[model samples]
Target: MLKMMTFFQGLPGQQSLLGTLDPGLSEAESEASMSEASSEDLIPPLEAGVTPDGEQEGTSKKKKSKGLANMLSVFIKGKKKKDQPRSSETEVKSKARPELEGPPPTVEELKAALERGRLEAARPVLALERELEAAAAAGGTSDEELVRLQSKVEALYVLLRDQVLGVLRRPLDAAPERLRQALAVVAEQELEDRRAAAGTRAAALVDTLWRGGVEEVAAERLGARPAGVPAGLSEAESRFLHMGRTMKADLEAVVERLKPLFPAEFNVVHTYAQSYHQLFAAHLDTLAQFELCERDTYLLLLWVQNLYPNDILNSPKLAQELQGIRLGSLLPPKQIKLLEATFLSNEVANVKLLMNRALELESQRWAQDVAPQRLNGYCHCELAIDIIQIISQGQTKAENITSDMGMQIKQLLLVELASMLRSYQHIFDEFLEKSKLLKNYRANIIANINNCLSFRTSMEQQWQIPQDSPSHLMDPLKELKAHGFDTLLQSLFLDLKLLFKKFTQTRWAAPVETLEEIIATVGSRLPEFSELQNCFREELMEAVHLHLVKEYIIRLCKRRLVLKTAEQQQQLAKHIEANAEAIQSFCTQNGSTATWLHPALPTLAEIIRLQDPSAIKIEVATYATWYPDFSKGHVNAILAIKGNLSNSDVKSIRNILDINTGVQEASRSLFSLIKVV
Candidate 1:
């Protein structure tokens, strides 16, 4: 029965009083008693001089007996009746705990220590925690409890963490200035990473999804909407239906973020500020064309149309839409605002600033390369037109916001157009110069076909000479004029054709009246002056002029003129109509209803008249008309050659260039113009 008391050390003061053991009790009985007693029992101690037979002890032994008696009594009681001393005498004899000191580690450090078997590092913390747990477990006095009140401490720690996370995410709700500072750091980080981070798919998706931060999140944020309202979902209900862990915020954002998300699909960032960079760099040979509405790039107006065929079919409506648009109606404020806010806000201040900047740059670019960057042919012109199309599309919906901006862009486009005109000017000067320097030894035979630049002139002479007689002047003139004039005309036609293809887009040609007027004016007047025919001083001048006007006027001029005699006019009209009918069989004028002007009309006419092929022999050197290049060299050499002439010498080697070429062949006013290296 006495041994039953030992196990109840759960009570206060229990372990100290239960130290003395009962010698008389058998080991089995003692252990069974210890095991049967609840862990919460208080055990009684044996008195120092007390016998197993319960004898009372002497005075000297009495003190020790009192200690033993106290221990024995404590061991006999269950833990429920136990009392621990305020300060244990054993604790007074125990050595004090060694001080622990180090740079404090976080919770993660303790976990790491537990994994690594670092009990020494953990002991200091474990001791402090154990002391606090023990004070609560022990029913300790007010002094012990006040020393470590953990419940209050844990509550404070939780409150602090919640407040911090809320402040970081919705910082404006707490402090606007912090958000601004954070945004500055974020922008700098993005710029630095813009190029280097292209291949990282994760970052690109982040950029796409996060275009609108708080504003979009707030707009999309679910609240406790009334359950029956259409499309309005309550926050808790949405959570319930979303299943698993996913929420509703991500689903609704799909459509609004297409463009922003597109780059991420490839995990690449294009450095271009605008789509125009695609023109030069995109693989055009393999390009799968999507023909979009020329006037509506912002909308879903694309179809599969190549540059030629579909263009030929719907060209009329396309031209009308492009040309007929009111400059003001092109751009609406809402679209301007949307594009700016959605795409252009970072780089452009507003549409006005954008247009102004473009104008300043375009003018600068034009002045630098106007001469070198000639609108060489249809290809060159199409590229320029494409750039215009992009500009037009962007500004089409930019009406009110684009006003001042549009004006600026218009000025730039005009300047670029002017640059193209200057390029044509250089080409034309090279043409006319060669025509001037051609010696009369070149038979100045005029072709009836002013239209076919490839045509040769035939000369018919009425000479009162015997069959054996030779006319030297007639022979040389006929030979030279037929070959030389044909070459010069071809070179001139090439230059004019280039300009025609470049400046005269179908968009501007619809009125027909304006194009006709342009032809008349360009044929008659030299640039920098209003005079109709003063710049030229040669037969070549008449040929160049006729060639320019004939494209527009051939059908008009080939018919009978009111100034000619009735019989002569009637004959001319008959031949002209027949030639025109033949012309329609091969070539097509680029207009609606698609007219074809014939390819062989002029050739057939020449062959009809020149019955003898031996009359003129065409040489390999004559194929290029070498007229343009030769003219440039001849003029530059002439001003320097200074009458020192010989047959084999360059000065006397009648270059074909002098035939259609001119002096001072420059596209500009010979002033300052900067160029990009």
Candidate 2:
């Protein structure tokens, strides 16, 4: 019981009741009394302190003392009624409200409560947003709530935008290193997005601005113009100039802005410039469709070309497209065709016609001057040179005009040159025929031949056509000149043959005057034959020498020297001396013929001077050794002229004949006819 009283004294608000408890009571009975008391009845009372109405400090203290006494009384009553049975009212009240009981909340439940608190805090903002959306969906209205909501939303938006911009802008200036790195990544992403968006917008804007500007300019330029009539740009020029200047400024601004971001990519600027150029091209095409005047079209094309300049045209990115947009392509098809015809086809045709006319005039002049009476004029046939010069001049003009046309003209000139050579050859042939009738026609013919050769030489030097020139165009000129030289050579030889035949037929007794005439006529002209003089003159002189020597031998054989009287022998010897002198004079006068004739002339003079048959036989044998044509007839004839020779003299002649003689049988018979002792 004492322990129970001590436990009761330790209980809060039960100390006052401890003194009232029966100390003599058993511990079990005291516990029963404490358990019987109601917990509310055991509660402490509130002390009235400061009241709303003004109250004295003593009254406040008395209220606090009365509250303390009431607290003590409740404590005593709760202790006194602890073992007593509860009243029916308290029991009924307890039954009416069952005691509430639950376990403590877990972490998840606490987290859920915190989330709910956050949601509850955001409810006002969400409600305001929903109201704003509803008002917007309802369309614009003067409703006060809607207006208030809109104003609120706008203000909220501005604040949010300022906050976002502030965050974005502040990092670069004030963020720490680590935060700055993160911001850089975000900034890079934003830049890429902006670039992509700008690319698309730029393309669309370029196209839109270009088309609008071009259309506006065109409308102003062509609105009142008549169909098929080109309009003057008095009014339109200003607009065009303005458009170009504006476009250039805009393009420069765009390039300057984009250059830093994409320094290596020309396409950024190329795309915009292409749009501007394409607009200009479209305008040009439209003007072309209206049958724009040549002058206007030219001026417009110039303007476009000048506006674009090499910087735009030669841009590595757009080179191919710019190459396609030349002045030629911008011109109308009809104009282009007309230009080609005028410069290329018509010019070539005109050159060919002029060449033909020049060639015809040259032919007529050649015909008029190449007459037989005007044989001296043959050397001065300026036809070929004149024709070549005219063609060359024409070629120069044509080349200045166009290279292709010049080439055609040059080819035609070559053909004409060949034709002129052929005509010259024809004139020469006619001249050759007429010349055959003249007494000294060979001289005239040689002069004409020399003139032709000289002209050909000059032509060769003047015109150095390449070997790779077209064969058909070049071959005729080459062949004709060569053929002309060959023909002239053949004609000269033919005339020579005729002159030699005439001399041979005269029995070599033709006067020195005749030989002199032949030499003067042909030899004087020899120097003019240029390179051909040596061979031609050598052969011709050889023929003359041979015929003259044969005739002299015959004349010597025919002479009858009667050596029975010294006076008669002297007369015959003098006759032989006169004939030998004539032969010597003829051979000496013509140097080309004298080479073989000179050695034989002295032998003939010796034979005549000795007047001995033995001397004749010795000389004749020596002459035969030199000239194999010397025959037995020559020996017999000379012996016959000597009359009867002494036996020793005849034997000496026969011994000379027997020395390995290989004469013909007919010539041997003449030897057999000789009577040798």
Per-model TM-score versus the true fold: 0.19, 0.31
Minimal lDDT window, size 10, model 2: 1-10
| Predicted structure 2: clash tally | 3
Model 1 TM-score relative to the real fold:
0.19
Kindly list the per-residue Cα lDDT of model 2 for residues 117-211, writing each as its tens digit: 22121223223333333222222222233333233322222232223233222222223443333233333323322332333333343234334
lDDT of each residue in 47-155, candidate 1, tens digit only: 3544654344576554443443344233322232324332232321232333556643433343344334333333433333333333322221232122213222222
Per-model tally of clashing residue pairs: 56, 3
Model 1 backbone overlap count? 56
Query: Lowest lDDT 10-mer window, candidate 1?
Result: 448-457
Off by over 4 Å in 2: 1-199, 206-348, 364-382, 389-503, 506-517, 524-677
